[model samples]
Target: MYKLYVRPGACSKAINVLLRDLDQKVEVIDARNLEGFKSISPTGAVPAMIDEQGNVFVEGVAIILHLLEKHNSAMLPKELLKKTDFIRWLTFANATMHPAYSRLFFLNSVVKDEAEKANTMKAAAAKVSEYWQIVEDKLNKQRYMGGDQINIVDVWLAVYAGWNAYFPVEVTIGPKAKAMIADVQAMPSFKAATESEKF
Candidate 1:
């Protein structure tokens, strides 16, 4: 069994969902309730996993790829070009989209002046929306970023979309993007992860 450390509603939530989607048995530990979390993750971040072999993995993308590749999950493409595409979309979701949303959280905590904070968040939100538009346009051509099947990127974006509720920004996800998120969330594994996280 895999031991996954996660914070409720965090990007770690996506990892939890992916684990279940792969039909892996995972013991979910709430990082907030765990002592010495840094021992598991040096940065003290959630979504850290200790595989059955007792190897520890940190970073959301790394853990995700490790699990998918190890399990030979169909969500990961085997063809050379398709594999590259998988990595591309994975980076887009984790590096591009996730950071766009994080800007809102960073600005919210640091910007003290209400006006400046609001303005900063609004601009950050616009940036996030731009990323969403990219997803929307891509989804218009394909059922999912992974082509016909739901992949880790889809789950990642779905989890990230929920973070808008934690900020004061007006991030507008396009209709197709919203629909994609909804579909990803409706997955049995996604539902199980959300309930396990108490979200």
Candidate 2:
């Protein structure tokens, strides 16, 4: 059995959805109450996983990949080129888009000075908008980030996009993004993971 340490509605939602989608039997632990989360993850981030063997892994992208690899799901294309593209989009969402929004949302936390925080929020909002435009373009062309079928990349991106409702970011994907997210949420697996957890 694997134990997943997560904070509700955090980036960990992606991992939870994926695990349910794969139908894997893993214990879910709320990191908010779980002591030593920082000891497990120096950054004290949510969505950390500990295997039955006691090996621990942290980070949303890493955990998603680990679950996909462990399940040996056909959803993850085995071809090198396809896999590379999957990785590319995953990295873009995790490293680029996620951080950009973080900066925008946490402007005050990131910057001490009031004027600097306002400036940072302004710049970060533009960058976040640009990134969403890129996402909108890709999603408009393909049903999922990995083309037709839902894959790890799509799940990961959806998790970040889910935050749009909570945070004020101009998401131009419009109806398409909403529909795509609806499609994923409609999945039985996704429902199972999110039914008890607030998203």
Global lDDT for candidate 1? 0.88
Q: Predicted candidate 2: what Cα RMSD to the true structure?
A: 2.6
Tens digits of per-residue lDDT for model 2, 19-111: 777877767777775677799988998878888789889887787787788889887679999888888888998899888767766864557
lDDT by residue for model 1 over 125-175, one digit each (tens)? 999999999998999998887777888898899999998888876788888
Which one is best on lDDT?
Answer: 1
Per-candidate TM vs. native?
A: 0.96, 0.86
Q: lDDT of each model, Cα atoms only?
A: 0.88, 0.75
In angstroms, the error of model 2 at 19 is 0.8
What value does the lDDT take at residue 176 in candidate 2?
A: 61
- For candidate 2, give the lDDT of residue 70: 84
Residue range with the least summed lDDT across 10 consecutive positions in model 1:
168-177
